[model samples]
Target chain A: MKTLLNKDQLNITLQRLAHQLVENHLSFKDTAIIGIQPRGIYLSDRIAHMVRNITGQKRIDYGRLDITFYRDDVQSRDIQVPSDTDIAFSIENKSVILIDDVLHTGRTIRSAMDALIDYGRPKNVELLVLVDRRFSRELPIQPDYVGHTVDTILTQKVKVYWKEKDGKDEVVLIDKV
Target chain B: MPLSVKHLLGIKELTVQDIEQIFQTADEFKQVLQRPIKKVPTLRDTTVANIFFENSTRTRLSFELAEKRLGADVVNFSASGSSVSKGETLIDTVNNILAMKVDMVVMRHSASGAPWFLANHIDASIVNAGDGINEHPTQALLDSFSIRERLGSLKGKRIAIIGDIMHSRVALSNIYCLAKLGAEVTVSGPPTLIPKHIESLGVRVEYNVKKALEWCDVANVLRIQLERQHKPLFSTLREYALFYGINKQMLDGLKKKIIIMHPGPINRGVEINSDVADSGQSIILNQVENGVAIRMAVIYLLSGKKDAQLSI
Candidate 1:
């Protein structure tokens, strides 16, 4: 396992991403932010907090989306207990930004897109990721906002850890021997 | 893990973990039901045949809707006006259906173990919709699902299976399922209607309906199987209703909030009063709604598509 981003690097990347979000979404009136469930939630929560701090916004509409049922590999894997999806506000005619920790197969993003439609049709949707594992995407999905781009093989797995969840914030790439 | 069994023959064949797995899958499908599209292309290439030798409206329609919603090609086969009426054997009829490249068979037969028998003879997956008084696995599953939904867990919860225990497949299946899930089960009914050796199944036997109601957290009232009864178990319907029937007054008399559940085709005045069936405490309608999702979960898991995902 190789450590790609330590605590300092992770914090710097989050601030940069939050600043970029504020620059593009400027008051975020008709904009909504959603975090992919299980892993993406921590990053989305961190970014949402950073964005609120940087933009001085009172409340940024953020929610969690679970794409377990919408995935392309339901039966093959062990039965999964689905996480809570708590989208309280409507995404109708809003600019929606979907956040995740890692982008590899791109199937998770595709499932997230499919699941997002069930809430309501958004005017537009964009993707943001903490780690973009280039050349391994199964679907034609590209992240609009990327924190780090790492070149990895199909055999390697990239994981992001947060202090709130893992007691430390770091991104690691585990390679199969 | 995904269910290890190739076919869902009965609740007897399913472990507690298997039932929980099915419920977890159903939970996901329940959310799908709430969506606007209300359909998922999960079983796109799969084909299922609903073969009912006995007559049914709710179970048949529920299974059909589940199959359709999961994007499976469905073929409905009723025994009436078919080869079975012309004295064809069960295997012959199923074999003929299987010849059509049917992937799975959802069967409801008048005779017990019909699905099990078919499972042994055929290569296709067999799901027992209901097989006589033997077991109705899906009904039991949905009942447990509804209980878990309302109460949050089944462990050590008190459930009273009221009325016709002797002839109820729901009672048998529920006994196995609820007991396996760590619920305290009590079968309450008149002496003749309560099956023999039921206590051996690890449930208390309650003779008085009022006392049973007072003891249980949930009362699953069942309709007296009028068609299945060759000899009269009770003298009159009025006498049974007066003694064992669940009504609003009886519920109010309990002075404790208890969830009311009934496997459908309820004998309105005979087993349960119309008012109580439609009351605030009743989860009968939720049971019906959950039936579709439960069936979809069963069909999806049994579809045997190792890597298939929900599409569209």
Candidate 2:
């Protein structure tokens, strides 16, 4: 296992991502932040919190979306209990930011895109990820904002741990045997 | 996560955890239904056959809609105007369908334990739509879901199952599901319509519908199935309505507001009056709406039991 980002480095990365978001979505009017459910929630929650502080906004249109039903591998994989998809606000004609912890094969992003169609049509969607596993994407999905980019083999797994959920904040690459 | 059993034959065979798991999953599907593009692609590769040996409208259509919403390939079969009338055996008919690469079967039959027998013989997962006075597991699930959605939780909730308990697959299923969820259930109807020794199922028996309505938080009134009754259990439909039918007057008489629910095809003035059925406290329509979500949850979980995986 190789540690990619330590405690202090992870904190700095989060702040940088938040600033980048505020810089692009100044005043945050028609833009909505959506965290892909389960893992993406950890990263988006922290980023959304930091953006709220930086922009001095009380609350932004942020929601969590679960793409389990939209996944293509339902027949093949073990069906796990789905996380809550709490998109309480409308995303119609709004610039949406889809956030996640890591971008692997891009299948999840594909599923999330399909899942998002049910909600009102967004003006546009941009992908944001903490770690982008370069050269591993099966779909042509590219991330707009990336904290770190890593080149990894097929068997290696990228895992991001949060302080709230995993007792610490860090990123690690595990070589699956 | 995987459901404990391969086939959902009856609620009696499900543990409380399994029921809870299904409920939790159904909660997610409920949100999916709210979306403008309500269809999900999870079951695209899986084909389901909805075989109804018995006639139905709501339950059958509910299952079909659930299957369609989940992106499943659905094949519908009915006994009437089918090969069943041509003296085809149950196993032979099902095996023929399975031969067409069907992965699951949703069935409703006139014989009790029909789904159980099918589950034992077939490899495909069998969901019991309703089997002759046995257990309509999904109906009970959606009913409980509707109650929980309205009243928050089922634990310690007083739910009175009123009317035609002896002939209702729904009442039996509801009793098992509610009891497992720490809910107190009561079977209330005319003594003749309710089965003997039903109290052994850990439910109270009330002969008076008014008394049951006065006692419970929710009254899950069941329809008096005239077709299922071989002989007249009660004197007359008018007399039955006068004594047992739930109406606006009963709610006004009750000290507390009691939720009213029915599975479907309500006998209108017989089991429940039109006024009460259309009342503010009635969650009968919500039960129908939740049926698709509950079914989608069950089918998705059971589909996970397959050992197949994409070669990634």
Candidate 3:
């Protein structure tokens, strides 16, 4: 099995992603990072931690969003968990960075963005994905930030296992050979 | 392949197995409470929209907390703040939200069966918080949960639900849930308010509270909102309270073990006496706490199953 983004490479990718966030985001103040729940949440937390360490800012709020209930795929999949929007701090007028682990067909990001707008309008919503796999997006959507891009067959699957979840930090491309 | 119930529209939409599955799942999720962290990552990437077309701070907040604790995102839309107040039809507003791709919808509308309409139109799972006074299935589930917790079993138990039967969705859902679980159900209310053919659902019906009170292990008092007294259903509030309210004396009429229950924001001295409301046997707060647990089960079960298939 060929490993993509081994532990060290994953660390570098996260650090680069963190630096990219710092460079792209104009101000640390009034900026909030909300991770799409499950994998995105951990990614966002890491991003937030990296941003804080790099910029030495302490006021930015990091939140987790579970977009289960607000899904078009509700008919196809059983929502294992109810959606949770745990924003301890208010999101009104704040600039939000919507973070996710992967960008596939762009449906989940669209849903996450939809979920974010309901909390109260943010000054801006920038989409950030760890991996950008070029697939046929059903909607006209694109990520504002990306860590890496990959081209794969439609039948192939990308499995992202983080140390916090699968006891390792790695991304695996599983092909239907 | 778990049973998915994203939005609960009404009890009418649920099969007996569907109802049983929810109760069972609620039983499992109840364990989370015993842990230090009362949260689950089941809905780790999902978001729930709480669309309330009615004024209900309690149900809205309960659903919100339930979603948050289960690790799902919650988006709230109230009639006052949302576009509905600006002459937007319920369909238009829901479609707009659906465009954003919400996973499930827990709706409470002033009009009866509005959530059903939304379920038909949208792809989100629908949980009917309250549809006018037609049905509050979760309230019924919580009420049943409280009863099951107190009695340990429901078979052959005499459970009497009193007050505003005609306009009480709580009474309607409770009747179905309790009867399904083998409770000897009796509904007592003014005949004017008690709808026709209600007794056909296999529950005994009575107009006199005293007669109903004498034969029950649990006397579940339904709230008597003044708004429900619409068009002079009753001549005087005092007369109604005196005649029907569950008070200290009424407690004596029943066996000492008969528990008192109310789905509150209580009418206080109106539907139930303050002493009874605050009494040792009052399961009102228990109902509130259990409401969340039952709702978590509902969200978990409802959201976990796919729409096109009935079996999970």
Candidate 4:
């Protein structure tokens, strides 16, 4: 079955995620929000804003991380390229939530986790993804908090877009076959 | 809260993944070049401003090419006729052009960390074309790209960055990138010009250039800043050449399969002899060409299309 999170639903999901994060981990003192570059950064920002409102003030620092280089499968492909990875702030010891739009084969998140560790070790590294399309596990990694979960076949693609990051808001699924 | 920049200050703020994406995207651009048209509409309607506070021919021209080829309107700015010469502050000058609502600003400055300063105040997206002697990120990207193209992989490769480590922004940036990408980087230069804390960045420092040249797969010769002689770093041009220049004889002692590189506008016989600069293994021109595509990747990413489905 195909499931999609419309704008309203996605907003609600984000609100709940923020509340859960606050309830599960009390106090925003050592909490830092890091969005995976591209989409995760927007979610991280949204979550940070929510956290600030809940605490009645700004209580968390945030950063954006790009994990394109840390991937293990780069050179095996036909292209061997590198790009700019911008993190406006430092990623010192703090509770970091590595945000990404979707969690699929888990390779991107895996690489992002590795890349984050290189910057510095955070006290707690949590994974928060918008969509979790269940499939066979590549690495033994799972999301700490998932907005929605759907079972899917291997020959499909899960896409997520946000107005702040992708110029629109919606989630779509496509048949790769 | 998150902020947007109209310019890229430096790669110091960039993580390995962002850089890797640039390389991956540039690698895609390289494939595009193989075709007959060799152009894309990815940056169509975007206006790119090349605001150079310092003089640069290759970097400026390459950025222009990258912008135009991506179908963006390109504007070239220099300090020669601008208000900068009249003692206008950088903020005032940047604020003036930003008022025009340009899409992006690609800048090169002489003062270290000047780009970061601009990024802090501006709302527009910024690409640090070159910032002082602090970072030449695109240069490092192109250099790394060229090395990967020739040597297959950057894993465990030994690279020696020779000359003026303390004064060479290329050396500083390269050490961070090369080391991050898994290259055992060694920086060799004169004792006075080599900073004491370079090893902190995971690079070994050496004072003897000849010895360093013999031990690596790649030898990056930094341009001897002719302007530094007056600052008491070195006595004379001839003295500088005698000690650190990459002459043809020095090339023979190093591994025959080694690659030679420079960030360009070479001083000919000073940092590198013309023969070595023009040698078969010299990837200087390739670096210049790769620089355009690599910069295109940087501009695309900093354009804030990170979440968009960017298809080549």
Candidate 5:
């Protein structure tokens, strides 16, 4: 296992991502920040809080989106427990930023895009990732904001950890045993 | 924990954890139902068949809508106008449908254990909508879901299932579900309507409606099911109404607020009065609304997709 990001490095990267969000989406009037469920939710929470603090916005629209039902491999799995999709507000005409922890094959983002349309058509949509695994794209998808880019073989896995959840802040690359 | 069984044939075959997991999944689907677009794409690659060997309106339509909302292609097969009228066997009928590439079967038959039998023979997933007086797993699930939604939990809650107990799949399934979830269950009706050896199921049998109502936090009143009655079990409808029917006057005389519930196609004045059925304490309509979500959850879970990590 290789430690790709330590605590301080992860904090700086998140701060940079937060700043980029505020700079790109000024005032965030028609913007909606959606965190992909499970892992992406933690990253989205961190970024949404930081963006709100930096922009001094009282109530920025934030929601959690689960794409379990919209996945391409529904027939191939053993068990599927769907997560909560708590998007109370309309995403119609809003600039949507989809946040995920790591972007690998890009299939999850594709499913998220398909799931988002059922709620409403967004004015625009962008992807943000904490880590982007390069040269492993299965779909025509790329991240607009990336914290780190790592190159690896097909057998490797990138594991992300958070202080609130995993009792630490780090990203690790584990080789297939 | 997730539902380990491939088919939802009966509540008797389910554990408390399985019931709770279905409710948890149904909770998420209920949120999806509240959205502007009340559909998910989880079962897009799948196909479900609604094979009703008996006549139905609510159960058939609920299963169809649930399948559609989950983006599954559905085929409705009724025995009335189909080859089953020509003496086709249940296995032959389902096998033919399976040959058409159906992935799941939601069946309601006049005979008990039809879905269970089909599950044993067929490769496709099976969900028993209602099999004679055997079980209606989804109805029990949605009923539990509604109870949990209103009362917060099923543990230690006193629930009385009133009216026809012998011919009601709802009562049997509810009894199994409530008992498994640790709810105090009581069945009240005429002695003939209450099944023999029902006390063996760990439920108290009450002959008087007032006594049952006085002891319960919720009363699930079932329709008399005149179609299923082979002989007149009571003197008349009026006599049954006088003895067991639920009315506003009877409820008001109790001097306490108790939840009222009825499985639909209500007999108006036979089992539950219109005044009480339409009253504030009645959750009949909410049960119907939760039916779609509950069925969607069942279908989605049994469709064999990988489980997503649940935050809650």
Candidate 6:
């Protein structure tokens, strides 16, 4: 296993990503940050928290989205316990930042997009990922703001850990068993 | 988490973990219902058949709506005008339905153990809507869910199943479900309506309605099954209501506010007065609302089971 980002590096990368978001969305008036549920929530929470702190905006449009029900292979795949979704603010005519930890197959983004439009049609949507696993695009998806990009094969995996859940903030790459 | 059990036939067979799983899933489903577009496509490729041998309005509609919300193609069958009136057998009827690629069956039958009988002979999953005064699992589930919504938990809670326990599948199912979840239960009514030796089921029996209402944290008044009365169990509805029916006065007399619930098709003044049924304390409508989610949880959790077996 390789340590892609240690604790200090992860914090630095998060600040960079947060700055990138603040740079694009000044005042965040027409921008919304949505974190995909389960693991994406950690990345979204960190990025959203940092963006709010950097911009000093208390009422920033932030939400959590669960795409378990919107998956294309819901039946054929292993059953996953669904997480809660709480998108209170209006996404209508707003640019939504769809955040996730890792961008691999891009199916999660597809399902997240399908689930997001149900709330309301956003003006546009942007992708953000902490680790961009290049050459692993099952769908035509790319990240607008990437913290790090790694060349990985199908059998390898990228794991992101956060202090809130894993008791430490670190990114690691694991080889196949 | 996936449910340990495949089909929700009755609460009697369900473990506390299963009930907890269903309730936890239904919590998310409730959120789903509050959305602008209240539907999901999890079961888009699945088909479910709701076969009701007995008459129903709410349960049938609730199951249909739940199936639709889950994106399952629902085919409803009622025995009133169907070929069952033309001397067809139960297995024959179900087999015919199954032959057409039906994946799941939700049935309400007049005979006890009908779902069990059908489950033994069928390839598809079976959900017992209600089986002849034996158990109505989903109703009990929704009832407990409503109680949990109001009080936070069913553990150590005092729940009273008031009125006709003899003929109520809701009563029996509620007793089992509540007991399994660590709640104290009491069945209160006249001797005839309250069956003998029901204490064997681990619930207290109270002959007086006032005492039952006074001692309990929640009162789940059950409808006196007038249609199921083979012989006159009580002299008349008036006498039964006078002594046993839940009214506004009884609720007003309680020292503390207790959650009022009823699995509906409520007898206006027979088992519960209109004032109490429509009162703010009553979660009768919430029970109706939660039915869809609970049924959806059951259907979604079970839909994947048969396919898992079929693949092997």
lDDT of 5 by residue, A73-146 (tens): 87886656777887878999999999999999999999999999989999999999999999999999999999
- Per-residue CA lDDT of candidate 1, range A84-175, in tens? 67787889899999999999989999999988987889999999999999999888999999999999998899988889999999999999
Residue B284, candidate 3: alpha-carbon lDDT: 85
Candidate 3, B119-177: lDDT as tens digits: 77777777899887789999988887788888897889999999988888888888888
- The estimated TM-scores of all candidates read 0.92, 0.97, 0.64, 0.63, 0.96, 0.97
Angstrom error at residue B198, model 2: 1.4
Clashing pairs in 6: none
The DockQ-derived docking category for candidate 4 is incorrect
Model 6 bad stretches (over 4 Å): B305-312
Where in model 2 is the C-alpha error above 4 Å?
Answer: B305-312
Candidate 2 per-residue lDDT, tens place, B1-312, comes to: 677788898999898988999999999999899888788888888899999999999999999999999889999999999999999999999999999999999999999989888877888888999999999999999999888898899999999999999999999999999999999998999989889999899999989888888889999988889999999788999999999888798799889888889998988899899999999998888999999999999898888647523110
Q: Tens-digit lDDT track for model 4 on B222-301?
A: 98775544477878778889999888887876556689999978998898999999999799898988988888777765
For model 1, state the Cα shift of residue B91 in Å. 3.0
After aligning candidate 4 to the native by TM-score, how far in Å is the CA of B147 from where it should be?
Answer: 0.9
* Candidate 2 DockQ, CA atoms: 0.78
Badly placed stretches (over 4 Å) of model 3 are: A1-177, B4-7, B305-307
Native interface contacts retained, candidate 5: 0.75
Q: Of the candidates shown, which would achieve the greatest DockQ relative to the real structure?
A: 2
Best of the two (3, 5) by DockQ: 5
Q: Summarize candidate 1's per-residue lDDT along B66-172 as a digit string, tens digits.
A: 99998789999999989888999999999999899889999999998888888778888888999999999999999999999999999999999999998889999
The superposed Cα distance between candidate 4 and the true structure at residue A6, in angstroms, equals 28
iRMS of candidate 3, Å: 8.6
Superior candidate under DockQ, 1 versus 4: 1
Give one digit per residue, the lDDT tens place, for model 6 in A1-177. Answer: 999999999999999999999999989999999999989999999899999899999989999999888888866755666788989888999999999999999999999998999888999999999999999999998899999999999989999999999998999999988
Ten-residue region with minimum lDDT total, candidate 1 chain B: B303-312
- Candidate 5, residue B233: how far the Cα is off, in Å: 1.3
Candidate 3 CAPRI category? incorrect
